[model samples]
Target chain A: MSLGIAIISLLLLAGKQIEEKFTRNVAGIDMVIGAKGSPLQLILSSIYQIDAPTGNISLAEANRLTRSPLVKSVIPLSMGDSYQGYRIVGTNQQYLDHFQAEFSEGKTFEKVMEIVLGAKVAQNLGLKIGDTFASQHGFDGEGHAHDEVKFKVVGILKNTNSVLDQIMTTPLESVWAVHEAGHHEEEEGKGANALKLLEEDDHHHDEAEHHEEEQEITSMLIKFRNPAMGMMMARSINQNSTLQTATPAIEINRLFALMGFGIDALKLIALVIIIVSGLSVFVSLYNSLKERKYEMALMLSMGASRTKLFILLLLEGLIISVIGFVIGIFLSRLGLWLMSENIEQNFHYDFNVLSLLIEEIWLFCGALLIGLLAAAIPSLGIYNINISKTLADE
Target chain B: MIATQNLTFAYSPSKQFTFPDFDCADRETMLILGKSGKGKTTFLHLMALLLKPTGGNIQINHQEISQLSVAQAADFRAKNVGIVYQKPHFVHALSVMDNLLLANYLGGKNQAKDKAQSLAESLGFAEHLSKKTTQLSQGEQQRVSIARALMNNPSVILADEPTSSLDDDNCLKVIDLLTKQTQEIGASLVVVTHDQRLKEVFEKQVLL
Candidate 1:
């Protein structure tokens, strides 16, 4: 019975937390533009930093979107490297301001190979300020290493309970420098020149030089001045250009709708289990009342009214239901804590299990009602007991 | 004091009973003897007011009791009468001491722990008061029941085949305790049983 309650409540807590956490992680961003592919993949890779990028788009072309009057601001992301399974996101200071990420120690990245670690990434990897480590080529942490250009951890961001907590942030030129070193066969000095671009700071110093070079970024996250303008821009970008645009709100809602079916099915099974538990409470109390019929009659003849004895029987059921609900809640919390620990180790996600849900209050009341009904049905027998007949028959 | 006159009961048209008149004064003891199928328990139930008499008047302490309502009967019984059954059943979940105090609680009287201890002491089961009733021997359980019946210091004590399940020695010992306790409390005592061994024990006897 407790297991049934535990399973039901745990599923509710987990499903609710997952939906809220995913929605909250999409804060501030309105749309994502990336290489032509599944729009959801673009949103997931760019906004959430969880999936691989579709493919890279030219930096000069992505920069053209910034000149549009409808766009409020843009944050370009350069991906394709990792450090111990945590994604290394290459963007500017605007991205940090967008997330309201604060520094626990040190400061933001200023040099080309300088990086700022998220709180979880720093804690898990035990990387301190000024520590340097070579980035791996892919997201799996098993790809070939870029040993030539080592990135130094310059800062550690405070815990924000967002996707920012599990990533390493660096300047965009650092990605170009690391990959340029990987393509050593093309030209050796290009990697050194990309490293020197950190001092130039003005990425668009020369348009002919920028477009002549095949420099690219994975995606651009954009927020529009108005919802109508965002729709117009998204439609134009998808139809008139080779890049794809995805609305974070729409793609995330579609993802949740797909997941809702499985969650609803589990909830139905949990409901049935709760009902069965109520039935078990009924059966046990019914059988006990049968065995104690003589005792009931004896108390009755000794001046106990039928109503008083009836309440006593109902109290037995009440106590059972109360105890079951309490233990069920405790067990569910324990289960969630264990799940959180496993998820933190692998996915770096934390689940808030301490907060009690309002729905669980209703579940408790339902359990109590079932218990009382089950007990009340059999307790009705107290009125029919004949004192003289029971004593004589025995 | 307890008395019943012209008592009649009918379970159906084919089943009926008429009982002899009887009375026992305060602090006095009476034994009503009969064989099985002779309405021994029915007569006891009539005086206990567990069943309403179809026609008769039962007076306890000179107050007519047979015509009392169901709730009133229960309240009156709780305050004025105590019963000892044949098999010595109890609320098995409680200890011997708690079982004794239950009488006071059900009777709407304050639970007297000191009174329960004293009763246990006199009944020779004081050391076993804290143990579950099921842990005691058959003879010890009967003594506990006797102590329970005296917890409220009622005006009447009814024993329904209380000693039928005991051996000859335990039977005499139980009857001695029952009569002695009733006398000490200044309550009337009545024993209804088919046991022939008790016929020679009581000075005042009636055949049902």
Candidate 2:
């Protein structure tokens, strides 16, 4: 009885961790806009960085988002490139502020050629301030370089335990300039460089005015002055404005609902464990009752009521239930801590801690109730056991 | 007082009752000792309302126990009867005190702690009152069981082979306590036993 309850207590703790981490990162962010793929994927990748990006957006459209009267701030992100496998994001200084990142080393980028490294990025890449590295054209660490434009490490952001921990940030001009550098090299000749041929390309592309405007951005993150204005602004932008808008909070909710299915499955498994454990308890108590049949009869003969004997059985079940509840909470915390690093890395969700969520407290209470209730049914054995007959048999 | 009139009971699948019409009265300490195959336990069960009689009826203080519903029978048993079993069961995980508390709860009454403590002290179970039943010796546990039985101050006390497992010393102590407590409550004392020694203590005995 004690062992089963201990296990239940641990599981309750684990459930709390998963819920807390998810709730923390998901708060406050209003909307994400980039590409045409899954809206949820865009939120996850853009806000949480666990999934693929939808597509890139133009810098002009990204700039236009900042001008919205409803906007509190705009965070522009430029991706589709990497420096030795670590993703290279071309965004503004506001991105760091969005995550409330403190400086571990150096400062935010001012010059377009400079890059700010995240704590994990700097630690993993072994880079320091003033060091320069060429970025690949794609997210892969080894993709062919575009112009080999060495970006100086200007800043290293302190670990915030958020998406900012794994990213590399630079000015939005760097992304546009890098991609525009790519097209410039592809068209200008086999061995031609973009920086040298930039003057000649400006003359040839003078008449293609639309291409010039579309060449600057990949995506943008929009925050509102009043967060509640997000729905109205997003609705207006999708219908009346030139670009599409995606709400990160709502989209992430959809993503979590999808993940909620996985949690639901875990609940089913925990339920089975509880049910099986309950049955084991029932069988054990039941078998004990049969073995102690003559004993119960004797107890009854000694002036104990059938009701008293029956309640004793019930009390036994209640004991096992309470024990199981405590155990489950501890097991849950052990599970959270065991999987803490991986869960934090992939999903930015921390589950290995003692801080209990409200929902988990309820779940823990429920487990205790289930254990007690389950035992109550089996405890009915005492009432059915007759005192006189059992005494005679003995 | 415990009384029965024309009491009849049948084991499942059996066509007839072992006793079609049977009766018992108070203060008798009736010993219904039959051979191994008789209906002694069945009669006790029927009387306790653990089983319903097929043909006749039984009553406790003129309340028709045989006619009581399942819930009422349970309540009736809790209020009126105290039983001592041969094997002497206890909740394995609970302390002796908790077992007594459970008795009070199941018997539908508040635990009178002074009564429990005094009874345990008298019965030699007071020192181990807080100890789990699993930790106690067999005689110690039997005494604790007895204390639990007396918790409700029941009107009828029944003993089924109460002395089958005890030595001469425990036999005297157990019977003396049962008899004294029964008299104090004005409750009837009915003991069913195979041992011949107990016959000397009772004023009247019925052999099945």
Candidate 3:
């Protein structure tokens, strides 16, 4: 019974926390446009960084969306590499400004291969401002290492309590430079020559339109000045181009709807357990009342009113409910803390379990009501005891 | 004092009882002797107000009790009457001391812990005061029941077949303690029993 209650409260608190965090993350971005695939996968990959990206789209084509009167800003993301499971997001300064990320050490990345580490990334990796590391090919932290292209950490961000805290931020040219250099060194076995290409690449950052048509990015995070205009533009983009547009709000709602089914089923099971516990209380009290019928009669003959005995019996139920509620809450908090610890290691997300939810107050009331009703049914026998007959028969 | 006049009761239409008139003044003792099937407990219950008589009136301390309502009868009984059953029963969960205090609590009087201690002392159960009532022997439990009856210092005490199961030796000893305790409280003691051994014990005896 307590396990049921613990699972119920834990689910409620964790579910609300996840929903709030997801909503806060998807707040500013109106739509995500990426290579053609599942819209939800695109949002989860590009925005949440929890999944594989749906291939890449041409940067020049994605950048054309900024010309639209309704478009406010478009941030291109190239995410194929990671440092020890933390994705190194390749984007411009607008992406950092979008999340209000504040640096704790050093400054923003300027030259190619220079990177700014999120707080969690810097702390977990124990990397300082001047430290440098080679990038891996994929986010799994097990892919091929680009040892030839070492990126210098110039800055470390403060804890934003968002996906940014689990990622590395760099200029888009660093991704292009690393992969192009790594590809050249593998083919020609010319490692030192790749360093010359990187230095030349840094000088061409402003006039990169010459090769912008060929450069590709994983996705684009687009914000529209007018929300209604996004709906129309999203439909046109999805129909005319190979890219797919996914609205963050719509995809996240679908995600929760899918998750709610499991939560509701668990709550139903918890409710059944609570009812069964109440029934057991009833059965035990009812059986004890039979054994104590003569005692009840004795007290009555000794001047105890039926109401007093009734309340006495009711108190047994009340005590059971209060104890069950207190233990249930304690167990729920323990369960949530363990779960949040696990999630923190895996997803860098923290759950605040300290706040007392209103739903838990209602759960306590519901438990007490069941307990009282179960006890009241059996305690009614107090009024029916014939004092004279019970005393004589005993 | 406790008195009854032509007290009558019927469990059903076929089972009925008619009792002879009797009265026991304060500081007095009376015995109603009968066989097992004779309604000896019925007459005692009538005086105790545990049951209402179909016809007749019972007066305890100058108040008509047979006409009292269920709630009123319970209240009146707690304040003015105490009863000892054939079998000594205490709330098994409570200690001997708590069982004695229970009477005072139910009677709506201040809990007289000192009186309970003194009663346990005089009744010779003071050593068992902190023990569960179930831990006592039959004789000790009976003595504790008598002490509980006197805790409220009621005006009347009714014992229904209190010694029916006790041996002759224990019976006389319990009777001696019960009478002595009632005399100290100035409450009339009425013992209803089917045991013939008690026939010569009391001066005022009524046979049914």
Candidate 4:
């Protein structure tokens, strides 16, 4: 019974924490536009950085969406690079402004190869201001390294307690420069050292086509001017363009709705366990009261009131429930603490288990009500005690 | 003083008892002797207000107690009556001193620890005050029971076959303690017993 209560409380607390974290990280960004794929995948990859990007979209196509009347602000993101498993995001200074991030040391990135580290990224990688590191081609550290252009850490951000804390940020041109240089190197390996011929080949195409072929971004985080038009804009984009738009709020609520079914079932099971425990308490008290009939008679003869005896037995049940509730709450916090460590390591998520909730107070009152009902049922026997009969029988 | 007139009780219509009238004044000791099932305990319970007489009145210090409500009877008993049962039932969870203090607690009076200590000292189990009641020998437990009955210094003391399981020496010691404690507090003592050995210990007697 105690274990059931603990597990239910932990699930409720962790669920709320995760939901709050998700909403806070999504912030004012109502939509994500990325390559055609699953809407949930786009939201998870673009907003949370917990998944790989669906695919890359042409920067020109993303720029055209920024000119839409329904759009408020658009921040383009170029991902697919990492340093020791921590993602290095290539975005403009607007991304930092969007998250309201503050720097702890040095300044924000302005140069192509200069970068600013989030607090967790800097601490975990032991990177300080002026330290330099090479970026790998993929989100994991095992990918091919861009060692030719070492990125210098120009600043370190203070702990924001948001998704930004788990990544490094740099100017978008750095990602283009690294990938473009890598492409040039591959061409050079084929003995095509004439870079002028490549420039002439680029000039031969239209400017828009050439830009699209040169620059491809992972996704765009967009805020809507009027949120009520979000679905309308998403529908138009999905039908008219190759790029897909996903509303973060809609996808997250769907995920929670699916998770809610499972949580509700577990909560029902916990309630049943509490009821069964109350029944057990009833049985034990009833049995003991039967065994102690003669003793109760003796007390009555000694001038202890029957009501006092009834309250005494009822208090026994109340004490048990109160103790169980306190222990169960403590166990839930301990379980959350243990789970938070694992989540922080895997998803870069943290929960504050020390924060008390009003729901827990209601839980305690519910437990006490069960205790009272269980005890009151059996303690009614006190009024029927036959002092002469019980003592004479003994 | 405690007295009962035409006291009667019945578990069922087939099992009815009509007890003879009796009275014992302050500082007096009386014995009601009977075989098993003769209702000696029933008559004692009536006088102690634990059982209300079905058809007659019981008077303690000239006040009719049979008409009292359940709460009133319990309050009256706690203030004026003390009972020593046959098996010396102490709350096993409590220490010897706590068992004595329970009487004061139930009676809704201030716990008289000094009085409990003196009673324990006089009853010759002062060292056992801090020990659990279950740790005491049967004879010592009975002595502690006697001390508990005297904790509130009641006006009447009732003992229900308190020495039925004791040997001759322990039986006399228990009866002696009951008589001495009641006499010290000027309370009437009534011992209802099936044990015939106690017939010679008191001058006043009623046989069922």
Tell me, by TM-score, which candidate is best. Answer: 1
Ranking by DockQ: 1, 3, 4, 2
Residue-by-residue lDDT tens digits, candidate 2, B38-133: 666676677767678887767677677788776677777877877666667875666888788777776668867888888888888789888888
lDDT tens readout by residue for model 3, A1-394: 4665677788888888888889877879999999999999999998988889999998888888656989998999999999888899899999889999998999999889999998888998899989989999997789999998899999999988788888999999999989876766754564446676675455356445636576889999999999897899999999998889999999999999999899899989988888888899899999999999988988988888899999999998888887888888889999889998898778667778787789999888888898899899999999999889998897
Candidate 4 lDDT by residue in tens digits, A1-394: 4665686688778888889899999989988999999999999989999988999998887788668888889999999999888898999999999989999999999999999999888887899999998899987679999887889999999998889999999998898878767766765665455685576457455656665665889999999899888778888889999999999999999989999999888888888888898899889889999988877887787777788899999999899888888888899999999999888777766787887677888888888998889989999999999877787777
Q: How accurate is candidate 1 locally (lDDT)?
A: 0.89
User: What's the lDDT for residue B197 in model 3?
Assistant: 88
Model 2 TM-score? 0.58
Give candidate 1 regions above 4 Å deviation.
Answer: A185-213
Q: How accurate is candidate 2 locally (lDDT)?
A: 0.70
Error of 3 at A136 (Å): 3.1
Q: What overall lDDT goes with each candidate model?
A: 0.89, 0.70, 0.89, 0.88
DockQ of each: 0.79, 0.11, 0.79, 0.63
True contacts kept of each: 0.85, 0.12, 0.91, 0.73
**Candidate 2 error regions (>4 Å):** A1-31, A36-38, A64-72, A83-86, A119-137, A140-154, A159-161, A173-215, A224-243, A256-280, A298-311, A345-349, B1-208
Q: Is candidate 1 or candidate 4 better by lDDT?
A: 1
TM-score (all chains, Cα) for each model: 0.93, 0.58, 0.88, 0.90
User: Could you list the iRMS of every candidate?
Assistant: 0.9, 5.4, 0.7, 1.5
Tens-digit lDDT string for candidate 2 (A1-394)? 3344344444445545444544555555677767666777776667766666777666666666557788877777777788776778888888888778899889889987789998888987799999987788766556778754778999999988766777788987777667666765666567556674674467466837645565555567777888777788777667765566777666656766887787667666666766787778778877877887765764554345666667777776777776666666566566667677666454444443766556656765665666567667766767676554555554
| Candidate 4 segments whose C-alpha is farther than 4 A from its true place | A144-148, A180-213, A228-233, B18-21, B55-57, B66-69
